[model samples]
Every structure is written in structure tokens, then in C-alpha cells.
Target: MVVYQSNSTNKRSRGFRVRSLSHFAERRVQSQKLPSHEDTYPEPGKSKVTEEKPRETRDEWVISIKDKVNKARGDVTASTWDKLCIYRVPHYLQEDDKKSYFPQTVSLGPYHHGKEHLLPMECHKWRAVNMVLEHTKKGIETYVDAMKNLEETARACYQGPICMSSNEFTEVLFLDGCFVLELFRGTKEGFTEIGYAPNDPVFAMGGLMHSIQRDMVMLENQLPLFVLDKLLELQPDTVYQPGLVAQLAVKFFAQLMPTGEELTKMDKVESVDLVGDNGELHCLDVFHRSLFKSTRTPDGKSLKKSMSSRKQQLIHCVTELKGAGVKFRRKKTDKLWDIEFKKGYLKIPKLLIHDSTKSLFSNLIAFEQCHANSSNDITSYVIFMDNLINSAEDVSYLHHCGIIEHWLGSDFEVADLFNRLCKEVVFDPRDSYLSKLSGEVNRYYSRKWNSLKATLRHKYFNNPWAYFSFSAALVLLILTLVQSFFAVYAYYKPSS
Candidate 1:
């Protein structure tokens, strides 16, 4: 008495009639779409027609196969036409770069999903799924069904074909999605409450958790927002907030953020927020968008660069700028990229350089370069810093100015970090977030008066001893000039 509905207009769904629900087990569809209308019923007394319909002619089979091939090709073409936010780090970009852009401890998406190094985390992933189900009092079927619904669109978000079968893909989505949700909730609420053991290695270990956070923000290792949203909907006893997931993601990675950078936590910006705050492609995208608050856009509204001037070299290094009478001051603001040049002062927000800073920034810059639509603020900032730091002395000068805060043990390491950041990175110096500042800095640097003044300051006014000597010398010279003038007047005017 069981009935299976057929939704496809083609023969695939039309030819199927199941007598029992168990008979439906063998049938599988490549797409996520489910069956619709009920299968046709026979008359009460009619005998079932066991005879098979006439087999299709060879020519008809050939045409049908051709149509399917063409449709698959069309699907691929359309999917590629839509930009996939997640991407492989280009090989050329990886060449000679010492920084590792790939996920090291854990892998979420298919790109690096079963690497030997990442296998250990897989156990925790299963634990996450089990914990989530237990907490919600739901079965594995609920998660599987939820993920299966998003199978096709989620597949489309990746760059190319996922080599896994539909079931495999859905299972991975279920496991990964639950792991992410549970991790976010665990971070917000402790793991013990989330049903993890007190000493659970993945959830409780601080070092592994740090590595996991790093791995999560990588461009290649990302799941789609829709997949996360689907699982978020299934969380029991949770009321939905518009951008709660995004907020959780930001909070999860907030510790890794370089010191003093402000992320606009709003889920939306008025017009320039292209991704909209909550709809970012990945954790890195969320971090990227958070950098857009009150930064240097000419109109104060647009994030787009004006590009009015030709591409110019970066102004000068810290030592060089100091020689050019430019002063370095730390700007007290949350916007990390907000750099300003005025009144002979180059105000840069404080930038903290840690061990993980290079890897984090490298991936973010790579994401910007590979994706056509993404902003290059990070890349531009790195390039800008590269131009301004040629040696350890430059780092020391910036450190003295409160611009660079680092745990790298030495200023030289800080200097080397920026110098190496842009070595193989793709950047247009002219099309930069700091282009306007570069122009202003160079203009100030090129002025003869400023350089001469700086030289005087360095030579005569550099120390208290030098200032005192210069003041005494100036007074002596003035008295000597007065004496000479009086003597000349006495000799010429004869007692007048």
C-alpha cells in the first residue's frame, strides 16, 4: 500500500512505482529535489501489467545520453559563471613563499578533507555531531535530511566537482556543520556544558583550539553560509538572531586579530557593504569586513579607491621618513588601516605582529587576489608596510613610535615580517588603500625646506647638549656682528 511520488517530467521518475517504502531504498537521485505527486494507482480488479515497456531504440538511447551530457555540461558552465567564494590557493602565489596557507591542524571542506595530518580532528567532528544530536534530542536522520536538502547548492559553492557521492557529501556537510555550530556554542558556552569531557583534547586543549581557529579562517577550508544557516535552524531552544552566526564567528577568531584593528560588527553597511555583514563567504571574509569602519575613503562613504594619481613608490622607510622631517605618531583608533599624513606627521594605527600574523595575513591577501570582487585592503596595507620597512632600524623606529607591537622577540623579526609579506604577493601600489597617504608623504619628503629643517634638527637640536651649544654660539655670533658694525661706522663717520 506504500506509494512513492514522481516529480520529474522525464522517464526517470515516471517509470518508477513502488509497492513498499523499502522498495524506495535502492532508488537515488543525483540532485537534492524530492519526489512530488503520488504514483498512479491501478483499478481495484485489474491485474498488474508485469510486461516491460518496449525498450528504447538505439538511436533514442543515443539522443537521451547526449541530452544528459549536454545538461551536465550546462550545469557546470552556469556554476562556474557564478563566482565561488572558496578557492584553492593558486600555485604561483605559493611559489617560494615560506608561509603555509593550507590548514595545518584541521580541515573542514573537501579540498583538504582527509589528509593524514587532519585525521585526528575527524574523531572530534563525530563527537561534535553526537553531542549536538544529544543536546537537541534529535536523531542522526534529522541532520542528514537537513544537509541533503542543501546538497546541490552547497556543492555549487565549491570551485569544481566534489569527487564524493551525494550521500558522502551530505554526510560530510552534516558532520562539519554540526562541528562548527557546537564549536561556536562551546566557545560561547563552555565545552563541559556542551557535553565534552573535562580534558577532551580538541575542545579543551588550548593549543589545538588555537590551531583550529587558524585553520577555520583559511580560504580553501571553508563551508558555505547556507550550510551553516541550515544547521543553525535545527538548534533546539535557540531563538534566531539576524547575524548571530556571524557574531559567533567573529568572537571565535577575535583573539587572532592584530592589535588595534576595529571590525565594523554591524551585519550591514548602508550601501558599500557588498557582502552584507552577516552574509560573508567565510570567517576571513567576516574579519575582512570588520576592517571597514571609519577608514580612509575619500567620500567617507565609498570603500573603492579613487586612483586619481599615477602609481607612486611608497613614501619612505621609518629612518628615511625621519630624515625627511616626517614625524611618526600612533593614531588612537579602532580602524586598523586608517593611516593619515598631515602637518608632517604620519599617523598609523598600532599593528601587532605575532607568530600567526604572517599566515593569517597571507591567506587573507591570497583570498583578495584570487577573488575578483574582494577588496585588496589587506594586500595594499601589507605592501604599504613593506615599503615603509627596509631594515630593523625601521622596525625599531616604528616600535619607538608605538606603531608596531610584537611578541617576535626582536624588532628585526618585526621588520622581516613586513619585508617578507609582500615578496610574492600581487599588489598594485597605485591602487592602494594608502595611495593618498603615500602621495602626501612623498610630497612632504621631497620638499627642500623639510629636509634642510630635519638636517638642522638632527645636527643642532638633536640633544640637550647640542641645543645648549647652538644657543651659546648663536648669541656669540650676534654680539660679534654688532661689534663689527659699530667699528665700521666709527671708522667711516669720524665720531658721528
Candidate 2:
């Protein structure tokens, strides 16, 4: 015990040195296990957790939205009290055009039953004998019944005759929905108080009839391909004969006109005619005479007075008609007395041309040429444009209709080409101007490239490699961008 105490300090110092050396060795091993600063901190803000964080998840937000949608569905279902809402499946969407809103009924032929006759073994003989015999037996009776029904319908829909003037010679009336220029044939005694008298006998019925016949003819001549197809479907034999149905339609339409002289005097000549073959009349000629009163420019002394007089007359006429509950309105384009009947307003263009006068023929021809050149089809846009240009009563009318666009300024050709290109890329929607233009351009290109691919494949048998080349080019472009990004980063990177 005495010897151990004497060396206590030295023993303590020896123990401390041994412990310190062992701790040093352990620390060295730990340091070797730990990552270096360069390895752990590649960039200042870089993360060290090798496994990526759950991408700062918005899973709760997504769940909330899903729950909200489910709740809405449940509410709608509950409120309806029906397991399925059948009507929610709309027949027509709002995006659909007006024409599409109406469901098309299946078209039936002349026979009331919707059936077509299939050819039999003895078809030619059966058709020649049986069809002819059947027609001879029933055609006249059927025609008479049809005419009677048509007359009844016309009477039911009658909107009273349009009275042009009180004078018997001047008065023209629209009766049974047909225009008639009457010449007074006779007078009634008691009717004098209501303005019917004897001396003013009517006479223009024949002329009016002639005019209607001409109008019908023009319409038949200008019938579009689609209309022809419909006509053929209704009367296949008539299509081959040509103008037969048109003539019949014109005659039927004429039957809608009033008989007698009082109806004929008011038939003003229209510029354009819709005459049927055999040159039968279909409608009155009124549009031409009323609009073009003179071909010569008015003398300075009378010009203002004439124009003023015309304007007043038109205004007065329209005002009187309006007062009488007529729906006719004086279009803003009118400089003089020009008014259009309102019922079946969409058909006004056709009707007006039917009633158009010879004075407007030149203008109509010009308009037709322009319209044909400008449009691939008789689209509504083209029709509207034609009306604007051809129907304008004066320069003021043209201005009022806002039809300046029809005049292709300096860039007409360019605009036309551009429109064609657009048409090539788009489909037609019939009435839509833009869609029609796009369709026209598409048609042009389609026709231009007809069978080109077939010819190429058959003649050379080479698969097109342009698409592959383009894809390869795109890949190379992406790699170049990545390489550029890395090169820039490397140049800007700090060195230790």
C-alpha cells in the first residue's frame, strides 16, 4: 500500500494517455465512415435524403374536389327523385345550328306509304303496261284532289290581298297568297260605296299570268343540284322529261292567284322572271317596275322633287299598310317606295326576283356573274351578298345594306386565294360564310391531288420518308438544347 501511493500521479497519467489513444482511434474510424462536405453538399441548397419527398403532396386538395363533385352528383340525383334523368340527354345541343334543331321525318314518296317498288323478273313489261295503266286510271283524280287541298290550305293561310291603289285600273291585289294585276271586268252597284264601280273594268290578268309563268321557268332553270335530286325522288319520270313538274308547280301556284280583271292591273313587272317551261307564269311581276322608275338620270330641276315624291309615296304606303296591321316594313335601304311583304320573309329574295322588272335585268346579270365568280356554291352568304348588291334601290341602298365587302378592293385576288386556302383546311356548314369558304378551298385542293398518292405508290412504290426525317430532326434539336444547357451550366459553375 505504501509503495502504490508513492507513484499515484504517474499511474494516473499513464491511464489517461491509454484512454485518449483509444478514443482517437475510434474517432478516426467514425470520420472515415462519414461523407465529405463535397460529397454531401453538391450545391448549397441540394437535399441529402436520397429518397425524394412525397412531392409536397396536394392529395388532400384533390380529395376535397372529388368529394365536392360526388356531393353535387348526389344532390342532383336526390332533387330529381329519379334514378336517371332521361331528358338531360338533349336532342339538340345549343352549339347546333337552327336547321339541326328539328328532327327530320323520314321522307315518303308520292305514295302515302313509305315504300319503294323492287324490280320483278318481268320489270320492263310490268312497268310499261301496269304503270301506264295505273297512271291513266288515277292520275287525273289524284291531281284534282291535290289541287283542292292546296286551295283550301291557301285560303286558310290567306293574309288578305295587298291593295296598291283605289283606282280600278291601278289596283293590284294579292289574293290566296298570289299576286294578281286585275283589270276591272264589271262593277257591283252596292260595292260603289266601298269603292267598287263599273267603268273601271280590269284587264291585266293575262300579262300577270305570263309574268308568273316566266318566273317559274327561271326558277326551274336555276334549280340547284340538291333540289333536282329531291324533285327526281318525288317524280322520277318527270326528271327525265324535264320541266314537267316545274310546269305543274307553276300552274298550281298560279291557281293560288285570284281570278278576274281587278287582280291584273296591279301586277307590276318584276326585273327577274321565274317562268316555267311552256313559259307558264308562277308569280306577279312587281319588283322591277316599282324600283326602277327611270333609266335616265333625272334633270336637276326635277331630281330632288322626284326623289322626295317617291320617298313620301313609299313612306305613306308603308305607313298605311302598317296601320292596317301589315307586317311589311320599309327597309333602311329604300330611297323611294320599296317595301317587302313579311310572311315567309326568308323566301322574299326568291319572290322579289320573281316579281323583278326588266329594268333590273342588267344589274341582276352583273350580280350573278360576280356571285358565281366569288362563291363555289350558292351559300346563304353569297345569296345575301347578291341581294345586297342586286336589290339595292340606289347607292344609298347599297351603303345602308353594308355590302361594300362584296367589292374586292385592291386585295381581291389575295383575299380570294386566302379564303380558298382556309376552305381547304375546313369543312362547310352550309349557311356559314367562313365554313363555305373553307369547304371551297378544301374541294379545290382535294380535286387537285386526286389519285396522286395512288399514282406514286403504283408507279414508284416508295414509302414516304419525309415524316421520319422530320422526327429525327426534332430529336436532334432536343439533344442540342440539352447539350447547350449543360455546357452553359458547366462554364458558370464555381470551382473549389
TM-scores for all candidates: the values are 0.78, 0.17
lDDT (C-alpha) at residue 135 in model 2: 31
**Candidate 1 lDDT by residue in tens digits, 111-147:** 8888898898898898888788878888888879988
TM-score of 1: 0.78
lDDT of each: 0.76, 0.29
Q: Model 1, stretches more than 4 Å misplaced? A: 1-76, 261-280, 293-312, 483-496
| Candidate number of the best lDDT | 1
Q: Pick the candidate with the highest TM-score.
A: 1
Any idea what lDDT model 1 has? 0.76
lDDT of 2 at 321: 23
Q: Summing lDDT over every window of 10 consecutive residues in candidate 1, give the lowest-scoring window.
A: 267-276
